[model samples]
Target: MRILFSSLVHTGHFFPLLPLAAALRDNGHELLFATGSDNHDTITSLGMTPIEAGIGLDVGAPTAAEQLGVDPDPKAERSPEELVRLIVTAFADVLPRRFVADLEPVLAERAPDLVVWEAGNLGAMIAAKRAGIPSIAHGFGRVGDDDFDVQGAEVIQRTAAEFGVELPGGRGFGDRYLDIYPESLQGKRFLAEEADLRIPLRPVPFSKPGPLPAVAEGERTRPLVYLTMGTAFGSAEVLRTAVAGLSELDVDVLVSAGPSVDAGELTGLGDRVTVESWVPQDQLLPRVDLVVHHGGAGTTLGSLGAGVPQLFLPQGADQFIHAGVVTEAGGGEQLLGEAFGADAVAETARRLLDEPGYRQVAGRIAGEIAEMPSPAEVATRVVKPG
Candidate 1:
């Protein structure tokens, strides 16, 4: 079978699909990745054929934004509710049309047997539907409450109209849904009441291939804490605070300042703290005792996969909800906007490290993740009907 995988340009959106794509490829299925031009190299680097489709906000002109008649100002302050609305309007509604437009030619040319898409990329589902092929909705994290109805409704309606297809009630995108999160971490609201529609796959942690850091080589004398604010939100101030707080403890700290943060800002912390612009979380998580991060779905699931307790300093988006799930599952703790600081972070790190219950719960969740179908198993199953 020829499987075509699609995602948005963002790393967080694109990375989750790789493990399953790899699984299918290893089984001798031909694979092609359809994403923005910016991600072509990343897709090619993973040994998959790349079909450049859609627009990258960072690389291309603001054609999508112009089409939507909205100016996106990253530094501008907006309420969380407003931000969510903006995201829904732009990425969910407007961008899917662009994705469909770009993907139509590929669907005609490639004629793939299956179209596996990241949950948010509604265009792939539309394109596949129009081409009369089955598609799978692969989630990045815990499924959002009402995500199918809320985020996908408009895109489905608009795209179905263009293809002259009738969408049955409650159908949004994809013939089947693939959720990677373990049952314990999947929030109550997002749990699928219908078992057959959703398939559970083990969340395998992956990152850009790289050599492990030297610090990860030796046996650790002290607990190791990994700190990151993710790619988009990392700042020098946050890095400094995290470094200061974690350095005060007996633990060794590995801080990924992200692309936005300057590594020089984290200098002079101490010998215990090693600061780098970035290090693959997959390379570091297994060796770390705990993770401190903005509760992005990828980071949250990655830490959980590694069985490492997390200290969540949630910034926004799904981070807040992921933080709640983490705390409720007894695997970690959360500090919201105002409460998040160096001192509070230090306190939570101490509790997570010293408290045996957190590790125990995290280990349990890890076991649950381990019990889910592996990517290879899922790849074989998905080729058949749901």
Candidate 2:
């Protein structure tokens, strides 16, 4: 079967779809990815055909943040709840207009057997429906958010009207759903219940091709701590705060501030601290003793997959929800808003290291993830060549 995949063309959104896409390719399915032209090189690097479709937020223009009068300083000022409203509105209301224009032509020509789209894309949903093709919804994080329904419906109403498309439910999640978020860490929104066919797939960790650095073999001299703020929310203020806290500890620290922030700004913090733009988290997660990071979905599940304890410093979006759920589950701790500082990061990371309960819970979560359906299994379930 020839399958077409779509995402927001951003790192966090695109990475989640890769494992499943790779699985289908390995199963002898022809694959095409519809994203921004900006990611054409990246898609080619991953050994897949690229079909340019969606556009990410243009900092040069007025975005949903500006429309909502919210300052988008890596979400330093607003709460995650406020940020989520902006996020949902942008993808569902604002950006879909452009996506429909770019993707309609591609849909007509490619005419793939099926479409699998990231949760943020309502345009892909609309395009697939217009083309009379089956599409499945793939989630990047926890089940759902309270803001998801309210924002998705309100904006989708206007969007449906403008496009003259009849959206049966005014919701983005499709008839079939790929549930990547583990039940242990799942939120109250419960996306599984919303879908007619819910397939629970394991959240396999993935990092772009990179050579893993050699860590000392047998007995460790000191615990290794990995720090990252994700590709989108790489704030120097938060990174410096985290590095300062990690440096205070006896453990050696490795930090990746993503492409948004320059490594130079993060350098010269401490002799024990090392900064880079990227690291192989798939290989590094198992070796690290603790993780200090923004509570992005990929890292949270990646660390849990490796059974590593964590300290969550959520900057914005769905991060705050991830932090709260993991903390409540006792697998890790979180620092938010006024509570986010060097001292607090130090304190929470210390608990993740010194405490046994956190590691114990993490191990249990890892076992559960291990038993869930793998990408290969779901690939077979989704399609079988007749």
Candidate 3:
């Protein structure tokens, strides 16, 4: 069977899905990995056919600040509302057009058996329904949350309606806010009224207990803490602050600055700190004792999969919500507020390293994650639905 796996440009969103795409290919199914133009090389390298889809909106964000020229490291600032507006404006109506324009050509040529869409791809789902193909929604973070599902459903309905696809009635809360979306999404109803367009969301396919990286033979043996603020927000100040805080303690620090921030820009770091732009969190998480992250979904989930305690410094958006979830699950701590100094970072690292409860909690979460199915198995189930 042929399958189309759609996602956004963010590596965090794309990487988690790649393992599944590879799994499908290995199982004798043809897979087309569709995403932003920026992700073309990465997708092809994973041994799947690549389709250049539309550019993605900044979902992981302080959306407004990012839009109106807010330098990532705002010397001093905080406004969640502006951030929300920036995110909504970028995606709502814009997402459908770009997604449809990019995908229509691909759907015309490939005509896949099924469509697998990331939660972020509102347009892909509509296109799939229009093409008379079955579509599956893959949940990446906190799939257990009911609120996210509700928001997702509303996004689907609003975006689809613009493309002439009718959504099942009965939406609540933020769903009503769809009216505030851009006017580009208004159009004729192309879908039949009775068509069952509701797609079931599948649990995240986290590969476990296999293909982990080996710890370096000469690796230093002090407590190891991995640090990241995510792809877009791992600012230079954050890196410097992390390095400074961790350096004071007796621990080995590995920091992945992500693509946006250059680790080289961080200066005056102690010898115990090592920085890189990218590290396979799936491989690195298990070997670490603690993780200090910006609370992105992929990092949080990857850390949980590895069973490592986290210190989440959520800057904005879903990070705040995810941080709360992590705390509720007893696997981590949410350090919020306008605090990003060496003293604050050091205290958090100390608590994470010296505390016994954090370790125990992480271990339990890791055990649960280990029980989840590999992405390949999940794809097999979806592709061959009974």
Best by TM-score: 1
Rank ordering of all candidates by TM-score, starting from the highest: 1, 2, 3
- The candidate with the higher lDDT, 1 or 2, is 2
lDDT of 1 by residue, 90-110 (tens): 565566777888999999998
What lDDT would each prediction earn against the true structure?
0.79, 0.80, 0.65
Candidate 2 regions exceeding 4 Å error are: 59-61, 65-85, 170-174, 188-192, 214-219, 384-386
TM-score of 2: 0.92
Could you estimate the TM-score for every candidate? 0.92, 0.92, 0.80
Error of 3 at 11 (Å): 1.2
Winning candidate number (lDDT): 2
Name the weakest run of 10 consecutive residues (lDDT summed) in model 3: 173-182
Among all windows of 10 consecutive residues in model 2, the one with the lowest summed lDDT is 166-175
Steric clash pairs (candidate 3): 164-190
Query: Which model is ahead, 1 or 3, in terms of lDDT?
Result: 1
lDDT score, candidate 3, position 296 = 80
